[model samples]
Every structure is written in structure tokens, then in C-alpha cells.
Target chain A: MLAHAIFFYIFSLIAIVSAIMVTVSKNTVHSVFFLILDFISISCLFIMIGAEFLGMIMLIIYVGAVAVLFLFVVMMLNVAQQKNQWFSARESSKHIPVGLIISTIIFFELIIVIGGWKYKPDLVSSMSLNIDSSISNTHAIGYVLYTDYIHIFQLSGMILLVAMIGAIVLTFRQRSGVKRQSYFSQISRERSDGVELIDVPSNKGVKSDD
Target chain B: MEYLSIIFSETYKILFLLVPVLVSVAMIVWLDRRIWAFVQKRQGPNVVGPFGLLQSLADALKYMFKEVIIPSSSNKVIFILAPIVTMTLALISWAVIPFSATQVLADINVGILYLFAVSSLGVYGIIMGGWASNSKYPFLGAIRSAAQMVSYEVSIGVIIINVLLCVGSLNLNDIVMAQESLWFVIPLFPMFVIFFISALAETNRPPFDLPEAEAELVAGYQTEYSGMMYAMFWLGEYANILLMCAMGSVLFLGGWLSPIDLFPFNVIPGAIWLILKILLLFILFALVKAIVPRYRYDQLMRLGWKIFLPLSLTWVVLTASFLFYFNLLPIN
Candidate 1:
């Protein structure tokens, strides 16, 4: 129990610091790297808390995929060259009051939720999908995810699909006079398309441009 | 006293595993060169020891004595940290890879997932190394690797899903035991093949080694690295290769399980069989390096996204349906 507490403190501290660094870091690449670090520490905490499946999946999706894309974009766009000024942008400062108000509201709401929450007397019995201690958490989550909440689960998948298609649609374009290789057409060509037994072909090059 | 003993025991176990892995990494380096040489009809590292056995060791010593020149314009901290991260992450995945039914470091329940997570994180090393070098070639190499890994990782995930459907459990032990009747390679042959190719791309082996295309990018991310740091990258690369081979053997080839049930074949220890399977897969990896030509950048992307992705996704659907309709899926 002491060890667990110690580790929880360590990981939570790292996560908090990295989360701050993600916003405050001067270099855009460093910010993305900090974001990655934040994800890792949170996942470590999750793993420490016995949610190994969640932890690993979070690592795979957030750190492995999302943060990588973030880094790729940050690196590719050369965003590190532009200095980030949180408070110095006079025009952007107009939005600061609104942001602070919204943040404080969210913070108060979190405090209320954490401090005022309590377990119902029959909370264990009320849950339709109870976690069984005998089985691993992975199995328990799989059992519930596939059977009990399959629709909501698939709804989220659909949302992701829509987002992906939207991104592609936003960026995809066809340009005129820009020759693109059709691999299928190039591959499926026949010998007849390349060679012909014309009598006058040898002398005139068979009007090769045609 | 009790905690101290536990710590000591764990450290001892770690060393027991680490020593052999380091030794094997050295041997695999030697083996890789020899295979390449055999394919080319030339001698490889034959002057060091018998059949060039100690050549890797000699190379290690040379690296140790050499000066590590950090580029003046580089981000010195991250530049030095990259290879260490690479080497550490490479070896870290081995903790979950079971050697036999009973022998493993962690033997965690989500072992395969753990492996997946670690392998996916391997890209950071290259990206960091490339970016920190403050050089154009390393940066380009890093960008190529980042994109290549991400693309190939998608197909790899889908392929693993096919295996997971058959096994029903995420545990490595369960996966091996689920293959007691037959190796997965026989039934999921297409997936196994696609998985191997993706593994090659994942580990950045030749044919897909665009990240380090010597003719184009001057060794890519390692362009600025030298001496022990460079050796670390090399060691880590081979270690990652071994890990991928280990994964292949475990998932498809019935890891540590004797192929035949007869007395002679079955008498062999499971660890030895596991090692043999890894070597066999490694040889295939090396043969691929020798025979295949490197892919164009666009072609590599096309292969990963256009071909492997759809093919692996279709295989996943087929595997899941076959198992579902026939009630052949393992029930844990």
C-alpha cells in the first residue's frame, strides 16, 4: 500500500508537470514531446491502479498514434520557429477573460464532483456490468464492451470513421495537367499496346507520339 | 529485510535475462553479416574468432575506445539521449516475451499488448535522434521513419487482431497453448505472411529501410552519431529485429512447442526450440535483406496503406467470421 501510494504520487506529479509543460514549452516540438510524456505518466498510473488493458490501450492510441501525428505535424510545419506568446498577443488578449471564466467554472465543477460524490448503498448491485475479481480486467471489460454496451461502442467507432473521412475529404484534390501514375493501368498493359508489326514503322518510327 | 530480498531477487532475474539477450544480440549481428556474405559469395568477419564469432565483441571494444563526437549545432541533450532510449526500449519488450511455458520476466496477462505498446514507442528514438542532430538528412530520415512506422503499424495491429480472435485471450501463454492442436500459420497463412512483411517494415529492415537509405540520406538518423552511441543504435536495431522474430515465432510458429511429439523431438527443452524458431525467422529476415531491393518512398507508403491495410482488414473479417460461424474460437 505504501509503495502504491509512493508510485501514484510520483506518476501523478510527473503527469501534472508534463501537462503544464505541454502548454508552456517554448518549442512546439518540445510541447508535443511533453504531451507524449503526459500521456505516458498517466498510463503508468493507470497500469499501477490495475487497469492494465486501459493503460496499454491508452498508450497505443494516444502516445503511439495521436502524439506521433502531433509531432509529425509540428515537425513538418516548422512551428518551432514561431515564438509562442501566451499573454503578449494584444489582439488575442481579448479572449483571455472568457477563457479564464470558463476554466474556473470547469475547475469548480470538478471540485464539487470530487468532494460531494458518494457511493450509493446498493451501488455494487445496481451496476448491470459488474467487474468480477476472479477474471482479469481485460476479460471483464471485453465481456461488457461486446455485450452490454455494444451500440454505444460502435457509435464511437462511427464517429471516428466520420472524422477520418472528413479529414480526407477536406484535403483530397485532383489537379489538371499533373500526370498521376495509375498503377493498375500501368501494370495491366499488354504487349500489343507497346509493339505493332506495321510495314512503314521502321522508316517513320510509326508516328511514335500517337 | 523482506523487501530487500525481493529487490535482489528481481535484479538477479533481470541480469539472468539481460546477459543472454546481449550475447544473442552480438551473435545475431555476426549471423546477419554471414548470411549477407553467403548470399553475395564473400567472406564476412572471419578473422576475429572461429567463423568470426568474436567479431561483434571486437567491434564493441572499438566503439568503446572511440570518441563520441556530438555535433556543435546539435541539441546535445536529446542527441545523446536518443540511442540510449532506443537501446533501452529495444530490450524492455523482452520482459514480456516468454521463453518457455514457465520462463518469462513479467508474464503479465496483457503480454502481447505490452509488446505492441513498446514496439510502437520505438519510433520516438529515431525521431528524436533525427531531429536533435540539427541536420537535414537525419531530420528527413526521422520523418520517413515516423510515417513508415505509423502506416505499417495499422496493418500489424489488424493482423494481430486475427490472431487474438483465434486465441480469445491476450496472454502469451494462452496464445501458445491455444495453438496446441495446430500452428496458426497453417490456418491464418495470409495473415502470417502479411504480418511477417509488416514486421520487416516495422523493424525498418532492408527493402523498407528508407529511413537509413545510405545512398540518399547518409545513414539517415544515425548520420551524426558515431562510436558507442552508433553501436548502441546498431545493437538496438538488431535487438528489435530479434524481438520481432520472437513475436513471429510466438504468434504463428507455436513458440517453444515441439513440432513433433516423438521422443527425440519432444525431449528437447522448450527454450531451445524457441531459440531455434527465432533463428529460423531471423534467417528469413536476413535472406529478405539480401534478395530484395529497397522500395521507393511512395511505393513503400502505397504498399503499407493501399495493399497491406485492406488485405489484413479483409483477413481479420474472414478469420473472425470463420471462428464465429464454426464456434472454433477459444473460450477462456
Candidate 2:
């Protein structure tokens, strides 16, 4: 129990510190890195709660893809020297009140939530409600999602498909005065006359007067 | 009390081998350089030790003595933690690996899951390292690595499921022991080859190492890392290679089981045989790196999705049919 609590505290400290740093860091790149660290420590907290699949997904998607994309955009934006200072100062000031209010609400909510719930780790473990160790966590999640939550899963897939099609349609463009290769052209390429080896004199290739 | 002491004593005894094996994994850099040198008709690293066995040690000392540098624009917190995450996850995967019948650190039933989990976490370190570097090349490398890893990981998982079907257990020891009758390589040769190649691609070894292609990305994700931190990445990479090769041995080869059991002279211990097989695989990996040219990124992705994935999926079905026809599987 003590061991679990100690690790929980450590992970929470990492999560909070990095979360704070994400806002406090002057550089956009540094703020993104702090955000990545914050997500990772949150994943650690998920693992502590025995949600390994969710934790792995958090690490893989949030830190791996989304954060990398954020870094890419930040690096490629080509922030001008004078713009950087102005940008940093304006960005930090813009969100101060909003962030403070939201954080305060979340902090109080945590306290209220903990106070309202009766703590019973043993009962939760025995009931197999919070902890399900019969099989790999992925298996249980898959079963539930495919069976009980099938409609929701299918709806989400449909939503994603619509979004993907909409994105392609929005981006589609036709350029003038350019010939595009046909897919059939690639498949129907003939080798006999299309390619040939010819012997040529090396000196005739190029000659320099000097 | 006596039983607990016995377990502790056995664990300590195994540590003697595990510690050295882990350390020697760092020596792979020396081996990589020397092997490539020989391939190119040059003598390599004859200075540090007899035949330069201690070159890696000397390099480690050099990295240790050098000053650590942090860029003023870099993310201080993540920049410091990145290499530690990389090295720790790289080293921890060895715990569940079975070197021999009695030489495992943790022979848990979920050993395969533990391995996949650890290796999957490896991408986090790479992503964080590049993100924290606050440089162009590293950022691009990190994005490329993220996409590459996520894409290949799905195929690797499916391929591993094929192996699990054959062995019917996730424990590394059990998987190896099941091969005692005949090597899984004999029956699942295609899977063995595909898995080996995919392992190379997953580790981002040469040819598939687009993330760290020097001519392009300028050291890739580790562009900002220097001194001991850079050395840590080197050690972590070599350790990952060792782990992957060790995994290949246990999954396909007879692992610790000697190939020639009919003969009376079984001189080598199972762990030694395991080590020998992994060395051979490692050499093969290096050889491929030396000979093969790097594939274009699009070509690499096309091969993974269009070629390896379909072939592996076919193999799974083929194996399933064979097993079903032979009454080898529990249908219920």
C-alpha cells in the first residue's frame, strides 16, 4: 500500500510540474516538450491504476504522434526574431485568467470527488470491478467494445470516415499544363522496346576545350 | 525461510551471467565497426585492447569525461529525461527473456506481453528526444519515426500472434521448450525470415534506418544529444538489437536446445547455445546492413503494407490450416 502510494505521489509530482512548465516555458518548442512530459506522467498514473492499454495508447498517440506534429508545426512556422518575444508574451498573458479558473475548478473537483467516494481497495479488487486480471487488458477491452459497445464503435468509425472523405474533398485540386501518369500505364509497361542498351563512345559524351 | 533463501541464491547466481550479457550488448558498436571494416578490407580499432575488445569501454570513458551540453533553446526537463527513458526501457526488456532453462530473470507467463510493452514504449523516448531538441532535422526525424514505428508495430503484432498460435504459450521458456521436438524454423521458415527482416526494420537498423540516415537527417532524433547522453543512446540501440536477436532465437530457433540431440556429445550448455545463435543472427543483421542499400521512405512503407503484411497474413492462414488438419489445435 505504501509502495503504491509513493509511486502515485511521484508520478503526480511529475505530471503537475510538467503541466505547470508547459504554460511557464517561454519557447514554443520547450512548452511542447513539457506537454509531452506531462502526458507521459499521466500515462504512468494510468498504469498505476492498472489501465495498461489506455496508458500505452496515451504514450503512443499523445506523446508520439500529436506532440511530434506540434513540434513540426512549431519548427516550420519560421517565427521571426522580434515576433518570438511578442508572441511569447502575448500568448502567456492571453490565457492567464482562463487557466487559473479552470485549474481551480479541477483542483476542487478532485477533492470533492475523493471525499464523496468510500475508499475500499480490497472490495474493489475482489469484485473484479476496478481490477480485471483474468486475461490481458486489451482482450477485455476488445470484448466489451465489440459486443456491448458495438453501436458506439460503429458510429465513431462512420464519423471518422466522413471526416476523412471531407478532408480529401477539401484538399483536392487540378493543376493545368501537367500530364499525370495513369495507373494502367505503370502496369502495362513493355520491356522489349521501352528500354534498350546502346554502346557509345565515352569521348563523344562530353568534351572540354581546356 | 529456507525456500526464500534458495530463490534469492538462485537469482544471484543467474545475475552473474545476466550482468555480463547486458554489458556485452554495449560492445556491439565495436563489433559493428570491426565487421564493416573487415568487409571493406581495412583493419579497425587495434588500439584499445587485444584486437580492440576494450574499444567500447574506452569510448564509454571518453563520453563520461566529456562535458554535457544543453542548448539554451532546448527543453531542459525532457532533454535530461529522454536518454534515461531510452536506456531504462531498453534494459528492462531483458528481465523476462529466457537465456536458458534455469537462467531467466523473470519467467512470468506474460513474458511476451512484457516485451511488446517495453519495446512499444521505446518510441516515446525517441519522440521526446527529437521534440525537446528544438531543431528542424530532429523534428522531422521524430515525425517520420513515429509513423514508421506505429505502422510496422501492427504487422509485428500480427506476426507474433502467428508464433503464439504455434507455441500456444507466451512465456519465453515455454515457447523455446516447445521447439525441443523440432525447430519452429523448419515448419515456419517464411515467418522466421519475415520476422527477422521486420525486426531489423523495427529497430531502425541500416537500410530501414531513415530516422538516423546521416546524409539526410544529420544524426536524426539524437541530434542534440552529446557526451554520456549520446553514449546512452548507442548502448540502448545495441541492447535493443541483442534483445531482438535473442527474441528471434527463442521464437524460431531451438533456443537453448541443441540441434543435434541424437549424438552423445552435447558439450555446450543451453545458455551458450542461445548466445551463439543470437551472435549469428546479429552478424546476419550487420551483414545485411553492410550489403543492402537504403530504401526510399515510400518504398519502405509500400513493402511493409503491400508485401510483408499480405505474405505474413497468408502464412498465418497456411499454418492454421496445417494445424487444423493435423488436429494440433484445441478447437473448443
Candidate 3:
């Protein structure tokens, strides 16, 4: 338990610091790197807490796919060299105080909620599907996911399918004047299409058609 | 005191596992070169040690002594961190790999998923390295890699789902144990082939190595990296290749289990069997690299999104339905 606590603290500290760095880093590329660090550290905490599946998923989804996309856009846009100034720009300076106030209120509200929250004495017992100690975390998740939460599971799959289609529809384009290989046309060509045998052409050579 | 002891033991286990892995990484590099050389009818690195066994060690020493170069316009911190990230992620994924029934570093429940996740995250190293280089070619390489990896991951995910459906467990050992009677490759040969090909693409091996296509991209993401930093990328690449081979063996080749349950075959230990399977897969990997031509960018994308996506998706459906019909699905 003590070791777990120590690891938890260490990971959480790294997560928090990196989370800050993600926002404050001057270089956009550096910010993305910091964001990745933030994700990794947080995932470490999750794994430490025995939610290994979720931790790994978070790493795969956020750090792997999403962050790479972010890095792609950042690099593609060529914004890494752009200097970031939080309050120096005159046009952006006016909203700073208001943003600060709103953020502080939200932070305080989160703190209050966390401080006031408490687990009920019977909460563990009242759960619909308790985590089975005998089975591994993946098995437990599979059991619940396929049985009790089947509808939600299927629904999430549908959502992902919709998202994939939408992305393709949005970005897919066909342009004119660009050559593309047509396997059908290429394969369908016959010798008669290009080759012609003429009896009189033996000595006179082939006549050019313009 | 108990916590201290546990920490000590864990550290000891990590050291025990890591040293062998590090050594194997070196050996795998040398072997890969030799294999590639043999395929091309050339004698590979024969001067270092017997059969050039010490070539990788010599290369490592040279890299260590070389000067570390950082581009003036590059983001120094990230430029350095990228290779470290790549190397660390490559090594860390081994934590959940079960060598045998009882031998494992960390036998977490979500072992396969953890592997999937870590391997997926391997893209960031390339992207960061390329972006931090602040050059056109490297940036282009990074973007291509990002798209390539992401596209391939979709099919890989579905393929894994097909396996998970049959085995009904994400734990690596459980998956291996489920194959006691019949290995998955015999039944799911198409998926095995697709998975192997996708693993090749995922690791940026030859044929699918568009990210570092020398004729065009000039070493791609490692364009600006030098010395130890460059060496780190090479190490990470080989480690990832090994990981993929291990994954292929575990998922399809019945892992550490002997080919048959008969007298002579079952005499060998499970760990040795696993190692043999990994080596076999590695040889296949090298053979493919030597034989196949590099794919064009558009064709690569088409293969990943069009061919593999539909094929793997259909396989998942077919596997699920077949398992259901035959009552072969493992009931958890």
C-alpha cells in the first residue's frame, strides 16, 4: 500500500507538471511533447491503481493516435517557430482578466466538490457487477461489456463508424487532370486494338495517320 | 520494510529481464544485417568477431564516442527526448510479455492491450523527431508516418479483436494457453498473414518503410539526428521488430507450446520454444524485407484503408459467427 501511494504521488506530480508545461511551452511541438508526457504519467497512475486496461487504452488512444494527429497538424501548419505570448498582444490582452476569473471559479468549484464527496458505506455492495477477484481485469471488462452493457457497447461502435464515415466524407476529394491507373482498361486491351497487319505495307512502310 | 523488499525484488526482476533484452537487441541487429547480406549474396560484417558477432557492440561503442549534433533551428529538448521516448516505450512493452507459463515480468490482465497501446504510441517518437528537426523532408516523413501508422492500427485493432473473440481473454498467457489443442494460425491463417504484414508496416520495416525511404525522404525522421540519438532510433526499431515477432508467435504460433504434445517435442522448455518461434518469425521478417519492393505512398494508404480494413473487418465477423456456430468460443 505504501509503495502504491509513493508511485501514485510520483506519477501524479509528473502529470500535473507536464500538464502545465503543455500549455506554457513556447514551441508548439514542445507543447505536444509535454502533452504526451502528461498522458503517459497519468496512464502510469492508472496502471498503478490496477486499472491496467484503461491506462493502456488511454496511452494508445490519446498519446498514440490523437497526439500524433496533433503533432501532424502542428508541424504541417509550420507554427512551431511562432512565438507564443500570453498577454503581450494588445488585441488579446483585454480578455485575460476575465479568463483568469472564470478559470479560478471553475478550479474552486472542482476543489469544493472533491472535498465534499464521500463514498457511501454500502456503495461497494450495491454495485450491479462487482469486480471478480479470480478473473483478470480484461476478463471482468469483457464479461460486463458483452453482457450487462451490450447495448451501450454496440452503440459506441455505431458512433465510431459514423465518425469514420464523416471524416472520410469531409476530407475525400477527386480532382480532374490527374492520371490514375485503371486496371480494368489496362487488362481489357487486346492485340487487335493497337496491332494491324497490312499486306501492302511490307515494302512501302506503314502510312502515318494524322 | 515490506514495501522496500517488494521494490527491491521488482527492481531486481527488471534488471534481470532488461539485461538480456539489451543484449538480444544487439544480437538481433547483427543477425538482421547478416541475413539481409546473405539474401543479397554479400558477406556481412565479417571482421568484428566470429561471424561478426561483435559488430553491433563495435557500432554501439562508435556511436557512444561520436559527437551529438543538434540543428540550430531545432527544438533541442524534444529533439533529444524523442529517441529516449522511442527506446523507453519499446523496452517497457515487454513488461507484460509472458515467456512461458510462469515466467513474466508483469502479468497484468490487459497484457495484450497494453502491448497494443504501447506499440501504437511508438508513432510519436517518429513524429516528434521529424518535427523537431525543423526541415522539410523530416517533417514530410513524420506526417507520412503518422498517417501510415494510424491507418494500419485500425486493421491491427480489428485483427486483435478476432483473436480475442476466439481466446476470450486479453491476458497474453491465457491467450497462449487457449491454443493448447490448436494454434490460431491454422484456423485464422488470413488474419495471421494480415497481422504479420501490418506488424511489418507498424514497425516501418522494408517494403512499408516509406517514412525513411532513402531515395526520397533522406532517412526521414532521423534526418537531423546524429550519434547516440540516431543509434537510439535504430535500437528502438529493432526492439519493436522483435516485439512484433514475439506478438505474432504468441498470438498465432501457440507461443511457448511445443508443436506437438508428443514425447520428444515436449521435452524442450517453454521459454526455449518461445525463443525459437520468435527467431523463426524474425527470419520470416528478414526474408520479407529482402524480397518485397517498397510500396508507394498512395498504394500503401490504399492497402491499409481499402484492402486490409475490409478484409480484417470481414474476418472478425466471420470468426465471431463461426465460433458461435461451432460452439468453439471460450465462455468466460
Name the top lDDT candidate.
1
Candidate 2 is graded, for docking, as incorrect
Between candidates 1 and 2, which one is better according to DockQ?
A: 1
Where is model 1 chain A poorest over a 10-residue stretch in terms of lDDT?
A: A80-89
Candidate 3 residues B101-130, lDDT tens each?
A: 889998877888888998998998898798
Docking class of 3: medium
When summed lDDT is taken over every stretch of 10 residues in candidate 3 chain A, the lowest stretch is: A80-89
User: Over the true interface residues, superposed, what is the Cα RMSD of model 2?
Assistant: 4.2
DockQ of each candidate's interface versus the true one? Answer: 0.83, 0.20, 0.76
Q: Compose the digit string of candidate 2's lDDT tens values, residues B1-332.
A: 77679769878866775688667775777888888788888898879989998988888999999989988998788888889988888888888878678878777665776677677667767777887787888878877776677667666767877887787666789788888888988888888888888888878898789988899999999998899999888788888888889888988887888888866526677888888899899999888888899978987887788888999888889888888899896222
Model 1 Cα shift for residue B46 (angstroms): 1.2
What shift in Å separates residue B172 of candidate 3 from its native position after superposition? 0.8
CAPRI verdict on model 1? high
For TM-score, the strongest prediction is 1
Error of 2 at A2 (Å): 3.1
Chain B TM-score, one value per candidate, order as shown = 0.99, 0.93, 0.98
TM, chain A, every candidate: 0.85, 0.67, 0.78
Ranking by DockQ: 1, 3, 2
